[model samples]
Target: MYSSIYGGIIRHKFPLYKPNVNLEQLFGKHILFLFSFLTHENLNRAIRGGALESTRDVTIANREHLSDYLKVRDEYLYELDVHLDRFLSSASKAKISSPFSRSALRSILIQLTAASKCKKGTLRYWPSAGPGDFLLSSTGCPTSAFYAVVIDQELSQCKEGVKVITSSIPMKPPLFATAKNVNYLPNVLSVMEAEEKGASSSIWVDEEGYIAEGPNVNVAFITQDKELVMPPFDNILHGCTAKRLLELASKLVDQGLLKGVATKKLTVEEAKAAAEMMYVGSTLPLLPIIVWDDQPIGNGRVGELTMLLSDLLWDDMVAGPDTQRIPVPYAE
Candidate 1:
């Protein structure tokens, strides 16, 4: 459970996401669920957190698959489900307004995949609608409603390398940094701010000079010893994509590809001298950061490990262990 700086508290689980806060300020009816599906190529990776609810659109492979990775997630989400409403308070946001539950997000992915009719681009489980702010309304729907749109698959073409810049942007403490919240102003601005500076994205930092995370993704790298290093999960978020990347990377240890995997406090200075660097997250799995503030990171190109790790994750999405791949029951 993470608390928003706006006196809001977010609870996570499939089909049941509730935010508790003062609706008196911002009408109780303007909110949406904060969840999205992560797909590889065109297949869904049924990775969830906090609450895992049942859906009629898709079927779990079996108890074994659930026990493999989702077992812990289920237990965690169940506890959140039972006490969802209990979080209601003045310090929390005041609504749950998504058109579909977390389960529906999964179900749609199944329905799409079962049709064998995917466009071969990419499919995302973003909310069909999202809440809007005071900045811009009047386009078509509620500034506070959720809408999902299909887009051309955006695979990074920066095979040579991509340039990244560090930002001095102060961050808003996420309501639940772990839970995916629909409110992402600070996140968006960081990126826009980065683009204005001719950089692709921004790396946010705290007042203490410690590296926090990327605008919308988690930061990770390799050390001289070949350790897959990520920052501590305290200030940053626990991303579903990042988790899967680590899981796949763990497998490479035995193959003598990676020395080990770990999470530690990473500073910018330490990062500049790393063996390799990449931004890990959903939608865009692992993107290599070749340059930070004009300094070349590792060999200044996408690392060999980065591609292998990406393939492992992509392969897992297409060919799952039955548990990882849910049979999306489509209506024939």
Candidate 2:
């Protein structure tokens, strides 16, 4: 339950409001679960609709309680000053180590739904690391860019497929690579190096030259015999799109269209020898890789299995069942 101000989050003090602190009351036969919303949308919603009903009137009208709350808030802000002071003097990078977040995208989607209804199409926040229960507060310099990909236009559509390079720097420790981290200084450099060498993307190779995954996506390869092989997830950031694509391929396995699915350490030679190679992530659900460095993989075009998986993924996203989506709860 600690808030990290290392990323310039605390300009003054943070409004670290205290929820119910009673042990017995909180842990009685009836358990009390709480969620905190620290976004502007949430605050506005509370005012427009209604929120914290039980404490709403009291918080606004009670002079003593209001004074005390304001005092505590100011005190918290002062503490932020102290922390910022020490942090600035410290040399090493500061990370806000907290609990591993669950359902982060889920919460964002809910807010996104609300945003859509309000016609407030933009929301901004600085990324932070910690276990979060919905309440988030952070920002960075307002930055925008004209992001464009310099795809190898010829190789992109080449049924023979695109070229990929092996990464010189291996992935970080298991946990660091397993979750999304904001530290992209090294990753950007690595991607640039790969692109400069004429590769569509890069495969992160371990010290022993075993392929872990990719810098931005999870890597997979299909054998000539029609087996889908993925790097072990224990050392890589799990990709949602990859998992869904694999799930959709289960029908293929049942119909004998595919052989099997496996997660194991794959060496560079093994991957290069694969019948087809692909990268899967949220953005590029399934992209093919035909050439690995100087060698050609299989027939050098996107594999049939890759195309099949891509079609299935696109279908699910574009026209999936209503049960798959959460409807926006727009105010009446």
Candidate 3:
């Protein structure tokens, strides 16, 4: 973990992550599940305290922070510039000031990845409003702070298909939805709804009945006409991976594998009728959706074109052009 408040990367004597046998046992027995009620006369005053130290951040009280989490593969940061650009744009939208310059932050992330020796995982960073008084306005906050962390994990292309449901939770309004902010309560509820119904995740349909996106990933569809279509970015987060997939899909069009590529508004009726469906995002890159709302999506199996597109993305992530992947300066 790297914290601007700490002035650099925080060293750990042990591995950054480890499976805890105790936590496993506790969760297995559902011991942490709570069902209790307590009455306190000072309950109203309980919300009047705030922390002024960076160690205890105001992130819980303030919902205006911005972030970017990107994949690190083979000691390289994938799509570094694209993700940084989006991160900065999001910061501008949220009015959060970055403690470091963009170039400095990029350098710090690369250094952090190299230091962690994490070859296959994610690098997530954030620029928060910093510690401040508990108030709706951020006027009490001092300078903003930045933090980044690297996780070590296994990475592989997603081949199997998953099911999805139409989210009953209301999607965020266009103002908040367009920018990547930390306010994700509705997204969390939408996914929980899907899980309760035995689905992998859920998709958001706008107030107008147009296909919006998945909980955290962008949705793409392949029409029976062999066209690759994605919902426009007007009311959704402009996904860096999704945009790159669009650029790469052009190759399919050129080779006659796909009829065309487009970004347009898609209705639920039009979307559910598609020959293939997939979710596009940073990690999964591409996840095939074989079923939606219990109905078989085009024969109830992973679409061939969907995997082909996944291969395109996977190959690019592993061995794409130099512009898309940056080699980390790991110490020899």
lDDT of each: 0.51, 0.48, 0.81
**Prediction 2 TM-score vs. true:** 0.57
RMSD (Å) of each candidate, 1 decimal: 13.5, 17.0, 9.6
User: Which tens-of-lDDT digit does each residue in 1-332 have in candidate 3?
Assistant: 67675567744232222334243243233222111112122342111111112433556566557767889998889999999998888888888888889899999989888877667888887788876776766787886777777766567889899999999999998877877777889999999999999999999999999999988789999999999999999989999999999999999999999999999999999999999999999989899999999988888899999999999999998899999999998878
- List candidate 1 segments past 4 Å from native: 1-105, 112-116, 119-158, 329-332
* Best-to-worst ranking by lDDT: 3, 1, 2
Model 2 scores worst on lDDT over the 10 consecutive residues at: 66-75
By descending TM-score, how would the candidates be arranged?
3, 1, 2
lDDT: the better of candidates 2 and 3: 3
The TM-score values for the models, in the order shown, are 0.60, 0.57, 0.87
- Pairs with backbone N, CA or C atoms under 3 Å apart (clashes), candidate 3: none
Off by over 4 Å in 3: 14-55
Which window of ten consecutive residues has the lowest lDDT sum in model 3?
A: 44-53
lDDT of predicted model 1: 0.51
Candidate 2 C-alpha lDDT tens digits along 1-332:
11122111111212333554642253343222222223323333221111111111111222101000000110011111222222222111223321222244224324333432322221122222222222232122121110000011111112336688877754677655654543455567668878999987678887777888776679888987889888877767665556666777787789897898877888888888899888876445578888888688898877898887777765665455453333444557
Task: Between candidates 1 and 2, name the one with more favorable TM-score.
Answer: 1
lDDT tens digits by residue: candidate 1, 153-173: 434423455678887667756
The TM-score measured for candidate 1 stands at: 0.60
Best by lDDT: 3
